[model samples]
Structures are given as structure tokens and as C-alpha cells.
Target: MSDHFLMFVPTDPTWQPTKADAERAVELFKSIAPNAQTIEAIFTDDVEFHHPCENWSGVDCAACGADLEDWFYETTDKVYRENHFADLSVTTPCCGLHTSLNDLNFVWPAAFGRFALESMRPGLDTNEEQEKAIAACLGSDLRKVWIHL
Candidate 1:
């Protein structure tokens, strides 16, 4: 069994929405996606590593087309082990080019005061239009992350 998650995070890395903002965003999301549920920000300090692909299997170095699974695994291990919440920047072994983890299209998880909304349904597409509405309510641009687990 697997679960799919579409997470929306603030575009500004340092922005954290207030409780009122979250509530408003939730209402906006509910208007368009009636099935979405409000999920309390559990991993408040955890920043997501998102790839363009749906699953980790398709991850590769942009410069050289080399597989990045091992690198991603290692990085995941380090982040969880160290409880690191700061942005991650690394040099790909394949091409030795510098890239910030944010550059790879990852969504930074909502911080302590903010809230994240989620919907768990197989094969549900990330509704960009709805996301934009929520972001507009929150007064910020949002970054979307699709997780298949």
C-alpha cells in the first residue's frame, strides 16, 4: 500500500504563516477541495526534498544524468540523524556543480506557527489552481511537493 501527499509550502524560505492565515488557507482549500483535511504541522522543522519526478526512482543529476538515489538517501540519512532544518546545499558528484537543495524543487515544510493541508487519495493530481487560491489567501507564493509513499 502507498499514500500520496501533495504539500504546499510558502515560497519565501523564511515565511511562516500565522494561525489566522492557516485557518483562512484551510477554508480556501476546503472550498475547492472539499475532501482535503487540515494536517497539523508535525514535521515543523523538516524541509522536504522534492524532485520533478513522482517518486525517488526518477531522480538524477541535472548536469550529467547520473543516478542520484544514493546521494539522496545519504542526504536524507544525515538530515534526519542530525535533525537539521537549515537549507541543504551540495555539489553533485557526477558533475561537481553547486546546487542548493531548494534549487531541486523541494518544498520547505511549514514552520512551527504555520499549518499544512493534505489529501490522501491515490492518483490525485496536485491542484495548482486551488493551491494558488490558498497561497493568495495566505498572501504568499507557494511551492508544491508531491510525495508518493
Candidate 2:
């Protein structure tokens, strides 16, 4: 059986909200996903990758528009080797330009962040207005990811 999850993360991977702010954001999310089996905020000591699991199409370099699957994986391997994505920096193999992994052009939505507000088996999808409102409440632009595992 697959477990499904919906998560929101800051566009800026390093951003961390205060406990109060997280609670407020959770409350706002709860209003939208009232039927979620579980809804809560998670804070990690270091940034973590949030991908769309089976929905992943691939990622590309934002600058040169080159397929970046191999580069992204190898880079992620190195980044997580020490501090688990303490750094998201990357140099595109095709363009040779510096950028963060979080800035890559993901075919499907994904994010890397130290904080997340997530719902398990939520059985719901959010609209643009709801997403924007939640982002405003969190004081950060967000990336929404749907996961199945």
C-alpha cells in the first residue's frame, strides 16, 4: 500500500519560522484540509529534499535548460554526505553556472527546506488562493509537493 502526503515548504530552503508562526501556519492549513488524517508542522536541524515521489518527471537546469537528473543526484549525494543538505549550492553540468538545487526547474513541484507543514492522507487539494493565503501567513513563498510512497 502507498502512503500519500501533501506538504508545503518555503521556497527558501534555509528559512525557519518561530514556533508561534509555525502554529499559526498549521492552523491556517488545518482550515483548508480539515479532513486530513494528520496535519502538523515539522522543523528539521538541516534542510531536506521534498519530491513528488512517483510523480517525479525529472529536473532541468534553469539557465541552459539541460536535463539535470544525473547532476542533481550526484550533487545531492555530496551535499547530504556531511550535514544533510546544509548547503544547496550547485554548478550546472551543462551551463557551468552556479545555482542552488532548490532553484532547479523541477518538472513537478518539489522543495528543499528546514521546515514543512504537511498532511497525511489529506484527501484534499488546495486552490491558488488558499496556497497564497497560507504563504502569506507563513511570511514566505511556498512550494507544494504531493508524495506517494
Candidate 3:
């Protein structure tokens, strides 16, 4: 992987509808379906480890549709040998590492890189700012070194 990642959005509305809402809950849900569908479209291909290609020389693989299985397996092995079982479990499919976020196009590293984008949250008081802060917390240094024994 080239250390690039993408961001994904949730298809379903995370919050519940309030009483007396003009649009029925079902209609709102139906509306969100398209957004979710778009998200899915973004992640059409797996983030695989590929050799160099003609168009993008020196790039290991196409960031959009690369298969991450090898990387995941190697990473799992490396972490296991290093005795990091907890991290290993988190990366495993049984743990939902691949589909955890649902949207596939969001590159793991790039999406995670949002935190490293800045030293601290730009705005901390507002809800959006707070949410970004939280994401930054989880995003920084999400990468792990693959060790071979």
C-alpha cells in the first residue's frame, strides 16, 4: 500500500426520527438509500497490493480497487509474531476490518490520515468540530509495521 486512504459515509441515518416529522421514517430511509448506494459505488474495488503499472509507474497498485487480502494477511502475521493479539483481532474480518466502515472506496490510510492533517482539531466547540476531533483521535498512526519472523 502507498499510504493513501479514502473516506466513507454511512448509508443509514444514525439518528432516530422525531415525533410529528413531516416525512415518514420510511421515506427518509428511502432517500438515504441513494447516498448509501453512492458510497458503495465509490468502494467498488478492493484495495489490493499490485505490482507497478504503466499509467502510474512506481505505484504498487490502483488505490481505488486494490485487494487488501495479502496486506491484511501479512499484517495479521506480523502483529501475531510481535505478540499484538489485540490489534490482530481488530484487523481480522471476523472483526470486520474490511467491511467495518461499509464504504469500500475510503482508503484505510488516507481516511485515517485526517488526524495527521493537523496537530489539533481546528474547531473544538461545535458538534462537527468535536466529531472531527474524535475521528482524528482514532485516525492518527492507524498504520502498523509488518514484521517478519
lDDT: the better of candidates 1 and 2: 2
Question: Candidate 1 lDDT, tens digit per residue, 30-117?
Answer: 5665565443332254554443244544456656777776786687567546756365567877888687544442233322113344
Candidate 2 — which residues are off by over 4 angstroms?
Answer: none
Better of 1 and 3 by TM-score: 1
lDDT of 1 at 149: 70
Query: Tens digits of per-residue lDDT for model 2 on 63-140?
Result: 988999987888888989966898788788897979998999999888999999999998789999999998888889
Where in model 1 is the C-alpha error above 4 Å?
12-14, 37-43, 46-54, 105-115, 122-127
Error of 1 at 91 (Å): 1.5
- Per-prediction TM-score: 0.68, 0.95, 0.20
In TM-score terms, which candidate is top?
2
lDDT of 3 by residue, 4-99 (tens): 212222122121123222123223322333233211112212222221122221111233455554554465467546643322223333324433
Q: How far is each candidate from the true structure, as Cα RMSD in Å?
A: 4.7, 1.1, 15.5
